[model samples]
Target: MSSQQSIRQQYGTVQANALKLDEEKAKQSVDALNTDLANAYVLYHQLRKHHWNVDGAEYDQLHDWFGDAAEDAETAADEMAERVAALGGVPVSGPAALESHATVDFEGEDVYDARTSLENDLETYGDVIEAVREHVTVAENLGDYATSEVLRDHLAELEADADDLRGFLADDTLVLESAMH
Candidate 1:
Protein backbone atom coordinates (compact mmCIF):
# COMPACT_ATOMS: atom_id res chain seq x y z
CA MET A 1 0.00 0.00 0.00
CA SER A 2 1.02 3.59 -0.64
CA SER A 3 2.22 5.68 2.35
CA GLN A 4 -0.93 7.82 2.27
CA GLN A 5 -3.21 4.72 2.27
CA SER A 6 -1.23 3.14 5.11
CA ILE A 7 -1.53 6.34 7.16
CA ARG A 8 -5.28 6.50 6.49
CA GLN A 9 -5.81 2.90 7.62
CA GLN A 10 -3.82 3.45 10.80
CA TYR A 11 -5.81 6.59 11.59
CA GLY A 12 -9.07 4.71 11.07
CA THR A 13 -7.95 1.92 13.42
CA VAL A 14 -6.92 4.44 16.08
CA GLN A 15 -10.26 6.19 15.82
CA ALA A 16 -12.12 2.92 16.21
CA ASN A 17 -10.08 1.99 19.26
CA ALA A 18 -10.67 5.36 20.86
CA LEU A 19 -14.38 5.08 20.29
CA LYS A 20 -14.45 1.64 21.87
CA LEU A 21 -12.52 2.89 24.84
CA ASP A 22 -14.91 5.77 25.30
CA GLU A 23 -17.89 3.44 25.21
CA GLU A 24 -16.28 1.14 27.75
CA LYS A 25 -15.56 4.01 30.06
CA ALA A 26 -19.11 5.26 29.73
CA LYS A 27 -20.46 1.84 30.60
CA GLN A 28 -18.32 1.63 33.73
CA SER A 29 -19.28 5.12 34.79
CA VAL A 30 -22.95 4.45 34.17
CA ASP A 31 -22.88 1.36 36.37
CA ALA A 32 -21.15 3.17 39.22
CA LEU A 33 -23.35 6.25 38.96
CA ASN A 34 -26.52 4.20 38.84
CA THR A 35 -25.52 2.30 41.96
CA ASP A 36 -24.73 5.54 43.78
CA LEU A 37 -27.93 7.17 42.60
CA ALA A 38 -30.06 4.29 43.82
CA ASN A 39 -28.36 4.33 47.20
CA ALA A 40 -28.83 8.08 47.44
CA TYR A 41 -32.54 7.76 46.78
CA VAL A 42 -32.90 5.14 49.53
CA LEU A 43 -30.99 7.34 51.96
CA TYR A 44 -33.09 10.34 51.02
CA HIS A 45 -36.28 8.50 51.88
CA GLN A 46 -34.82 7.22 55.14
CA LEU A 47 -33.73 10.69 56.12
CA ARG A 48 -37.14 12.11 55.33
CA LYS A 49 -38.71 9.48 57.52
CA HIS A 50 -36.36 10.34 60.35
CA HIS A 51 -37.07 14.03 59.90
CA TRP A 52 -40.76 13.43 60.32
CA ASN A 53 -40.59 11.06 63.26
CA VAL A 54 -37.70 12.15 65.44
CA ASP A 55 -38.71 13.27 68.92
CA GLY A 56 -37.47 14.03 72.46
CA ALA A 57 -35.44 17.04 73.63
CA GLU A 58 -33.47 17.26 70.40
CA TYR A 59 -36.50 16.75 68.19
CA ASP A 60 -36.42 20.14 66.50
CA GLN A 61 -32.72 20.10 65.82
CA LEU A 62 -32.68 16.52 64.59
CA HIS A 63 -35.67 17.17 62.37
CA ASP A 64 -34.02 20.12 60.73
CA TRP A 65 -30.76 18.29 60.25
CA PHE A 66 -32.39 15.22 58.74
CA GLY A 67 -34.49 17.41 56.47
CA ASP A 68 -31.40 19.10 55.14
CA ALA A 69 -29.71 15.76 54.62
CA ALA A 70 -32.69 14.44 52.67
CA GLU A 71 -32.65 17.50 50.47
CA ASP A 72 -28.95 17.11 49.76
CA ALA A 73 -29.35 13.42 48.98
CA GLU A 74 -32.21 14.11 46.58
CA THR A 75 -30.11 16.67 44.75
CA ALA A 76 -27.20 14.26 44.53
CA ALA A 77 -29.47 11.55 43.15
CA ASP A 78 -30.78 13.86 40.48
CA GLU A 79 -27.29 14.89 39.48
CA MET A 80 -26.21 11.27 39.17
CA ALA A 81 -29.18 10.43 36.97
CA GLU A 82 -28.41 13.42 34.78
CA ARG A 83 -24.79 12.36 34.49
CA VAL A 84 -25.86 8.87 33.41
CA ALA A 85 -28.15 10.31 30.76
CA ALA A 86 -25.39 12.62 29.51
CA LEU A 87 -23.21 9.58 29.07
CA GLY A 88 -25.92 7.97 26.87
CA GLY A 89 -26.94 5.51 29.56
CA VAL A 90 -30.34 5.15 31.16
CA PRO A 91 -30.50 5.52 34.94
CA VAL A 92 -31.79 2.44 36.72
CA SER A 93 -35.06 3.29 38.46
CA GLY A 94 -36.78 0.03 39.24
CA PRO A 95 -37.36 -1.23 42.76
CA ALA A 96 -35.17 -4.28 42.24
CA ALA A 97 -32.41 -2.09 40.90
CA LEU A 98 -32.51 0.16 43.93
CA GLU A 99 -32.59 -2.76 46.33
CA SER A 100 -29.76 -4.53 44.62
CA HIS A 101 -27.60 -1.45 44.25
CA ALA A 102 -28.11 0.09 47.67
CA THR A 103 -25.25 -0.58 50.06
CA VAL A 104 -27.09 0.41 53.24
CA ASP A 105 -30.14 -1.09 54.84
CA PHE A 106 -32.68 0.49 57.17
CA GLU A 107 -34.85 -1.96 59.04
CA GLY A 108 -37.96 -1.90 61.31
CA GLU A 109 -41.23 -0.08 60.91
CA ASP A 110 -40.80 2.34 63.78
CA VAL A 111 -38.69 5.42 63.90
CA TYR A 112 -35.40 4.72 65.59
CA ASP A 113 -34.15 6.75 68.52
CA ALA A 114 -32.17 9.91 67.75
CA ARG A 115 -28.83 8.28 68.33
CA THR A 116 -29.58 5.16 66.32
CA SER A 117 -31.02 7.10 63.41
CA LEU A 118 -28.08 9.44 63.29
CA GLU A 119 -25.67 6.52 63.46
CA ASN A 120 -27.46 4.82 60.57
CA ASP A 121 -27.30 7.99 58.50
CA LEU A 122 -23.62 8.35 59.26
CA GLU A 123 -22.90 4.80 58.12
CA THR A 124 -24.93 5.21 54.95
CA TYR A 125 -23.13 8.42 54.06
CA GLY A 126 -19.80 6.73 54.70
CA ASP A 127 -20.73 3.96 52.28
CA VAL A 128 -21.71 6.51 49.64
CA ILE A 129 -18.45 8.38 50.06
CA GLU A 130 -16.49 5.18 49.60
CA ALA A 131 -18.51 4.24 46.52
CA VAL A 132 -17.87 7.65 45.00
CA ARG A 133 -14.19 7.29 45.69
CA GLU A 134 -14.22 4.00 43.78
CA HIS A 135 -15.95 5.68 40.87
CA VAL A 136 -13.34 8.43 40.92
CA THR A 137 -10.64 5.82 40.64
CA VAL A 138 -12.38 4.22 37.67
CA ALA A 139 -12.75 7.59 35.98
CA GLU A 140 -9.10 8.34 36.53
CA ASN A 141 -8.06 5.01 35.02
CA LEU A 142 -10.22 5.68 31.98
CA GLY A 143 -8.71 9.15 31.50
CA ASP A 144 -12.07 10.74 32.12
CA TYR A 145 -10.76 13.62 34.17
CA ALA A 146 -14.02 15.56 34.16
CA THR A 147 -15.97 12.71 35.68
CA SER A 148 -13.14 11.99 38.10
CA GLU A 149 -13.15 15.58 39.35
CA VAL A 150 -16.90 15.60 39.80
CA LEU A 151 -16.85 12.32 41.74
CA ARG A 152 -13.99 13.61 43.88
CA ASP A 153 -15.98 16.69 44.82
CA HIS A 154 -19.01 14.55 45.60
CA LEU A 155 -16.94 12.17 47.71
CA ALA A 156 -15.49 15.06 49.68
CA GLU A 157 -18.89 16.56 50.38
CA LEU A 158 -20.37 13.24 51.47
CA GLU A 159 -17.42 12.53 53.73
CA ALA A 160 -17.74 15.94 55.36
CA ASP A 161 -21.45 15.46 55.91
CA ALA A 162 -20.88 12.06 57.48
CA ASP A 163 -18.18 13.45 59.74
CA ASP A 164 -20.40 16.30 60.86
CA LEU A 165 -23.26 13.96 61.66
CA ARG A 166 -20.95 11.64 63.53
CA GLY A 167 -19.60 14.52 65.57
CA PHE A 168 -23.11 15.59 66.50
CA LEU A 169 -23.97 12.07 67.56
CA ALA A 170 -20.97 11.75 69.86
CA ASP A 171 -19.39 14.42 72.03
CA ASP A 172 -15.82 14.20 73.33
CA THR A 173 -17.02 12.68 76.56
CA LEU A 174 -19.07 10.07 74.75
CA VAL A 175 -16.13 9.18 72.54
CA LEU A 176 -13.83 8.86 75.55
CA GLU A 177 -16.36 6.67 77.34
CA SER A 178 -16.79 4.46 74.32
CA ALA A 179 -13.05 4.05 74.03
CA MET A 180 -12.82 3.05 77.67
CA HIS A 181 -15.75 0.63 77.43
Candidate 2:
Protein backbone atom coordinates (compact mmCIF):
# COMPACT_ATOMS: atom_id res chain seq x y z
CA MET A 1 0.00 0.00 0.00
CA SER A 2 2.47 2.63 -1.14
CA SER A 3 1.36 6.21 -1.88
CA GLN A 4 3.43 6.14 -5.06
CA GLN A 5 1.60 3.04 -6.23
CA SER A 6 -1.80 4.62 -5.50
CA ILE A 7 -1.05 7.67 -7.60
CA ARG A 8 -2.87 7.86 -10.95
CA GLN A 9 -2.68 10.93 -13.20
CA GLN A 10 -0.34 13.85 -12.78
CA TYR A 11 -1.02 17.56 -13.10
CA GLY A 12 -0.29 19.49 -16.31
CA THR A 13 -0.70 16.34 -18.38
CA VAL A 14 -3.73 15.68 -20.54
CA GLN A 15 -4.93 12.10 -20.77
CA ALA A 16 -7.10 10.45 -23.40
CA ASN A 17 -10.81 11.14 -23.04
CA ALA A 18 -13.84 9.42 -24.49
CA LEU A 19 -15.16 12.69 -25.88
CA LYS A 20 -12.75 12.34 -28.84
CA LEU A 21 -11.48 15.87 -28.50
CA ASP A 22 -7.92 16.38 -29.68
CA GLU A 23 -5.49 16.14 -26.80
CA GLU A 24 -3.73 19.36 -27.77
CA LYS A 25 -7.00 21.27 -28.00
CA ALA A 26 -8.22 19.75 -24.75
CA LYS A 27 -5.01 20.90 -23.12
CA GLN A 28 -5.70 24.42 -24.29
CA SER A 29 -9.24 24.32 -22.92
CA VAL A 30 -7.96 22.80 -19.69
CA ASP A 31 -5.49 25.61 -19.24
CA ALA A 32 -8.26 28.15 -19.78
CA LEU A 33 -10.58 26.39 -17.33
CA ASN A 34 -7.86 26.21 -14.70
CA THR A 35 -7.29 29.92 -14.94
CA ASP A 36 -11.02 30.59 -14.60
CA LEU A 37 -11.09 28.24 -11.61
CA ALA A 38 -8.43 30.33 -9.91
CA ASN A 39 -10.28 33.57 -10.67
CA ALA A 40 -13.51 32.12 -9.31
CA TYR A 41 -11.86 31.22 -6.00
CA VAL A 42 -10.31 34.67 -5.65
CA LEU A 43 -13.73 36.21 -6.19
CA TYR A 44 -15.25 33.79 -3.70
CA HIS A 45 -12.87 34.62 -0.88
CA GLN A 46 -13.11 38.37 -1.44
CA LEU A 47 -16.89 38.24 -1.50
CA ARG A 48 -16.96 36.13 1.65
CA LYS A 49 -14.74 38.62 3.43
CA HIS A 50 -17.02 41.47 2.36
CA HIS A 51 -20.03 39.47 3.41
CA TRP A 52 -18.61 39.04 6.90
CA ASN A 53 -17.45 42.64 7.30
CA VAL A 54 -20.25 44.56 5.55
CA ASP A 55 -21.85 47.24 7.74
CA GLY A 56 -23.35 50.75 7.75
CA ALA A 57 -26.82 51.68 6.46
CA GLU A 58 -26.92 48.88 3.90
CA TYR A 59 -25.63 46.17 6.20
CA ASP A 60 -28.41 43.63 5.78
CA GLN A 61 -28.76 44.01 2.04
CA LEU A 62 -25.02 44.09 1.37
CA HIS A 63 -24.35 41.17 3.68
CA ASP A 64 -26.89 39.05 1.85
CA TRP A 65 -25.64 40.19 -1.54
CA PHE A 66 -22.02 39.41 -0.80
CA GLY A 67 -22.95 36.03 0.62
CA ASP A 68 -24.92 35.14 -2.48
CA ALA A 69 -22.11 36.31 -4.77
CA ALA A 70 -19.65 34.21 -2.79
CA GLU A 71 -21.87 31.17 -3.25
CA ASP A 72 -22.06 31.79 -6.98
CA ALA A 73 -18.28 32.06 -7.20
CA GLU A 74 -17.94 28.79 -5.35
CA THR A 75 -20.35 27.10 -7.72
CA ALA A 76 -18.53 28.45 -10.75
CA ALA A 77 -15.22 27.23 -9.40
CA ASP A 78 -16.63 23.76 -8.86
CA GLU A 79 -17.96 23.62 -12.40
CA MET A 80 -14.68 24.83 -13.90
CA ALA A 81 -12.64 22.36 -11.87
CA GLU A 82 -14.85 19.50 -13.00
CA ARG A 83 -14.60 20.67 -16.58
CA VAL A 84 -10.82 20.74 -16.38
CA ALA A 85 -10.82 17.09 -15.32
CA ALA A 86 -13.25 16.17 -18.05
CA LEU A 87 -10.83 17.70 -20.50
CA GLY A 88 -8.25 15.16 -19.17
CA GLY A 89 -6.24 17.62 -17.12
CA VAL A 90 -5.89 17.81 -13.38
CA PRO A 91 -7.77 20.71 -11.75
CA VAL A 92 -5.46 23.19 -10.12
CA SER A 93 -5.58 23.18 -6.30
CA GLY A 94 -3.89 24.73 -3.20
CA PRO A 95 -3.96 28.42 -2.31
CA ALA A 96 -0.56 29.08 -3.77
CA ALA A 97 -1.45 27.43 -7.07
CA LEU A 98 -4.81 29.15 -7.21
CA GLU A 99 -3.21 32.51 -6.54
CA SER A 100 -0.62 31.88 -9.20
CA HIS A 101 -3.25 31.08 -11.80
CA ALA A 102 -5.71 33.76 -10.68
CA THR A 103 -6.14 36.74 -13.00
CA VAL A 104 -7.67 38.94 -10.24
CA ASP A 105 -5.91 39.66 -6.97
CA PHE A 106 -7.70 38.91 -3.72
CA GLU A 107 -8.90 41.87 -1.68
CA GLY A 108 -6.93 41.83 1.57
CA GLU A 109 -8.04 41.95 5.23
CA ASP A 110 -8.93 45.63 5.34
CA VAL A 111 -12.65 46.03 5.95
CA TYR A 112 -14.22 49.05 4.30
CA ASP A 113 -17.66 50.62 4.26
CA ALA A 114 -20.45 48.86 2.35
CA ARG A 115 -20.17 51.25 -0.59
CA THR A 116 -16.43 50.81 -0.90
CA SER A 117 -16.80 47.05 -0.57
CA LEU A 118 -19.38 47.00 -3.33
CA GLU A 119 -17.10 49.08 -5.51
CA ASN A 120 -14.22 46.66 -5.02
CA ASP A 121 -16.53 43.69 -5.64
CA LEU A 122 -17.75 45.22 -8.85
CA GLU A 123 -14.20 45.71 -10.07
CA THR A 124 -13.28 42.13 -9.27
CA TYR A 125 -16.45 40.88 -10.99
CA GLY A 126 -15.53 42.88 -14.05
CA ASP A 127 -12.13 41.25 -14.14
CA VAL A 128 -13.64 37.79 -13.75
CA ILE A 129 -16.20 38.48 -16.44
CA GLU A 130 -13.52 39.59 -18.84
CA ALA A 131 -11.41 36.52 -18.19
CA VAL A 132 -14.44 34.27 -18.60
CA ARG A 133 -15.23 35.89 -21.91
CA GLU A 134 -11.73 35.21 -23.18
CA HIS A 135 -11.86 31.63 -22.01
CA VAL A 136 -15.19 31.14 -23.73
CA THR A 137 -13.54 32.18 -26.95
CA VAL A 138 -10.64 29.85 -26.31
CA ALA A 139 -12.98 26.93 -25.69
CA GLU A 140 -14.87 27.70 -28.86
CA ASN A 141 -11.69 27.84 -30.90
CA LEU A 142 -10.59 24.54 -29.43
CA GLY A 143 -13.94 22.96 -30.35
CA ASP A 144 -14.77 22.38 -26.70
CA TYR A 145 -18.36 23.49 -27.02
CA ALA A 146 -19.33 22.18 -23.58
CA THR A 147 -16.66 24.23 -21.90
CA SER A 148 -17.57 27.26 -23.97
CA GLU A 149 -21.23 26.90 -22.99
CA VAL A 150 -20.32 26.59 -19.30
CA LEU A 151 -18.19 29.72 -19.37
CA ARG A 152 -20.83 31.61 -21.36
CA ASP A 153 -23.46 30.88 -18.70
CA HIS A 154 -21.12 31.95 -15.90
CA LEU A 155 -20.24 35.10 -17.82
CA ALA A 156 -23.89 36.10 -17.92
CA GLU A 157 -24.28 35.49 -14.19
CA LEU A 158 -21.13 37.45 -13.39
CA GLU A 159 -22.35 40.36 -15.51
CA ALA A 160 -25.68 40.35 -13.72
CA ASP A 161 -23.94 40.39 -10.34
CA ALA A 162 -21.71 43.23 -11.45
CA ASP A 163 -24.77 45.19 -12.59
CA ASP A 164 -26.34 44.71 -9.17
CA LEU A 165 -23.19 45.97 -7.49
CA ARG A 166 -23.20 48.97 -9.81
CA GLY A 167 -26.77 49.74 -8.73
CA PHE A 168 -25.72 49.66 -5.09
CA LEU A 169 -22.85 52.02 -5.81
CA ALA A 170 -25.06 54.35 -7.83
CA ASP A 171 -27.38 55.09 -4.94
CA ASP A 172 -24.98 57.21 -2.89
CA THR A 173 -27.89 59.12 -1.34
CA LEU A 174 -26.79 58.16 2.17
CA VAL A 175 -23.86 60.57 2.13
CA LEU A 176 -23.72 63.27 4.79
CA GLU A 177 -22.65 66.88 4.25
CA SER A 178 -24.01 66.96 0.75
CA ALA A 179 -22.19 68.97 -1.90
CA MET A 180 -25.33 71.10 -2.29
CA HIS A 181 -25.36 71.96 1.44
By lDDT, the best candidate is 2
lDDT of 2 by residue, 6-107 (tens): 558988899988789999999999999999999999999999999888777667888898899899989989998998888889999989999999999988
Q: How close is every model to the real structure, measured as TM-score?
A: 0.79, 0.92
Candidate 1 Cα deviation (angstroms), residue 126:
1.6
Using alpha carbons, what is the TM-score of model 1?
A: 0.79
Q: What is the C-alpha RMSD of each candidate to the true structure, in Å?
A: 11.5, 2.8
| Candidate 1, 44-90: lDDT as tens digits | 88889999889766677778988998888888888887777666577
Query: What C-alpha lDDT, on a 0 to 100 scale, does residue 144 get in candidate 1?
Result: 69
lDDT of each: 0.75, 0.89
Name the weakest run of 10 consecutive residues (lDDT summed) in model 2: 172-181
